[model samples]
Target: MARLGPLLGALVKIRWRTLLGRGSAEITGEVLMLLAAGLMAERFLQYLPEFPVVWVWVGLAVCWLGMSRGPEGVPGQFPLTRGDRMVVRTVELAVNPLSWILVFVTGRISGWGLCLILLAGVEWPTWRRGKRVSARPSRWPALLRKDLRAAVRLFDTALAGVIVLMFVAYAVREANLAVEAAWIVPVVVALSNSTIALNAFGTDNGTGFDRYLLLPLTGREILWSKTVSLVVLVGGQLGLVALAASWRLGWEMGLVVGVEGLSLLFLLAGWGAWVSVWVPFALKAYRFADGGSVWAGLVAFALCLGPGMAAARGDWWVRLLVLWVAGAGCWVMLGVAGRRLERGRERIRERLP
Candidate 1:
């Protein structure tokens, strides 16, 4: 226990070296995060002049949250312990003058403020526990499994979890009241991921796209792999939202929304196949951008989102018929896009790495 201070200091130095090695990939997002925190802190300090005691407690809570992230390592990975909690945020705690100012301000805190010091700065050891993963890949299709893994690495699950929480809160607040707002869920999902689906091959670069061409599968099969993966990934988000709808609206409403959302996903995926062939662009690793061709993107959105928009106004039975029609039309679109894909293989390759 006497060596704890030295251990923390050593860990911070080690973390700095690790940051210098792999920070480039994460620096963009992390810097933006710091800027936002700085802005909030500036406003907080301005307010502190009037109600110094109240804001001091708030500052302590903020610091505690900054340190209280999930276990340092992922599930099924190596573990990081109490002494190893050093991260970029920990670096900020030491190096940032604002942190010390908060500390200095906190020292002036007399009664309850002093009690919080033990809770705020002291690292709790139990927080290091992580879930054990039962990773059974054979249960999932190859393409879907790959896409799911990519989604996890990209933190898409975090975004979906946040959206699901929002829906849950809305449902709980309107516990007895029900509305025909299920259609809005699909609309939000589509708009959020429209450009991502359209540029499906962009992240792969030439090497990954070439690997697809080299496979024994036909062009249509390659398109199927890409398109189906997008549906499965995006559909997971829709499924969670629909489950929340069931709790608030009713099971019947949940079924209607799920079916409607699946139809929208199919139509959008078909449109995405065409866009992938027409306006494919290479992307730097670990980044996202608009699909590069605004005209193509707008056209895709217009064609694909109609079913979802119409679902809001139509009857449930009418939507069932529309789903069948959509699935058929999407199949046809995919077939044509696959043919064009083969013809434009060289052109697509030129746009990638």
Candidate 2:
């Protein structure tokens, strides 16, 4: 344990430098956005007479997504022992608390804060270890399977799902709640799923794309593989939320949530594929903006909210139509994204360090 300190520091330093190298402008923009968000949140808490429990759910979702996903740095090319991996993760876990400092500053520290802190502590040792992928045709399944495994291994994802289920159970039991408020369930699911879908191809920072380009596979095939994996991952989260809502709120509300959730997920994954190729960003150790992640979040919010609004109106036919259109649109977008990825391989290569 004594020998692990230097190793962890060195790994964290490398990851930090890689993140800052993206660009000064990009980092500045993200920081500004974050500050603005924090200020807005502080104001919301101050002035809003009745802060909905929905935001609590959203906060938990964000915490889970952020904590469960492992560090995005490229895995060391040399072999690492289990101890080396554990030390590397310890460094990553040490950084998690810095985010909560914002909450403390905003004077919002409460049971929720304590709960999230405790949860992060409990899950810290479970960070997914990075894997080395080979650039071979037969390795595609292995690659996809690895991603699927990571998705499930995310302790935050599972915990967030359970919390959502409990919330649904409570919401369904309340007779005074407006039907329009049911939209929150799907919206939350959409936001939660987007954390993974939006960075589909950029999951391993910018390192994997180089190997991907080397593989004897068409961009379309690669894109499809990623899409399938994302659907499986994000779809699982959305499905759980839908099932819980259905069980508690009756099949009618559940049907709406299901359609809305699926539509939003498809839109996010399809659009994310295009972004992954066209505006590809690196999911660096400290930064989230590799490939227009901020813009993607904004776009996802807009898209998700649209379905939520439609759901609140209680128009089942309209909701179904929206779902059909979004599904078809994603299909077309995926094809275009594949072609773009192929054409832009040189550009993507240049973006990587």
| Residue ranges of candidate 2 with Cα displaced over 4 Å | 1-141, 148-166, 169-178, 285-297
Candidate 1 lDDT, tens digit per residue, 1-353?
A: 34445555654565455446445635565455445434434432442343543444444334433332323433114344544444433543465333454555555554456535533443343343464755566533765666555443332233333444444544655555345446665665665566556777766778878877897877788888877788777787788777877777779777877887788787778777878888887543322242267787677667556666566677867787778777887788788888988989999999998
RMSD score of candidate 1 (Å):
9.4
Worst 10 residues of 1 by lDDT: 67-76
lDDT of 1 at 341: 87
Where in model 1 is the C-alpha error above 4 Å?
1-140, 152-161, 176-180, 283-286
lDDT of 1 at 193: 61
- TM-score of decoy 2: 0.63
- For lDDT, the strongest prediction is 2
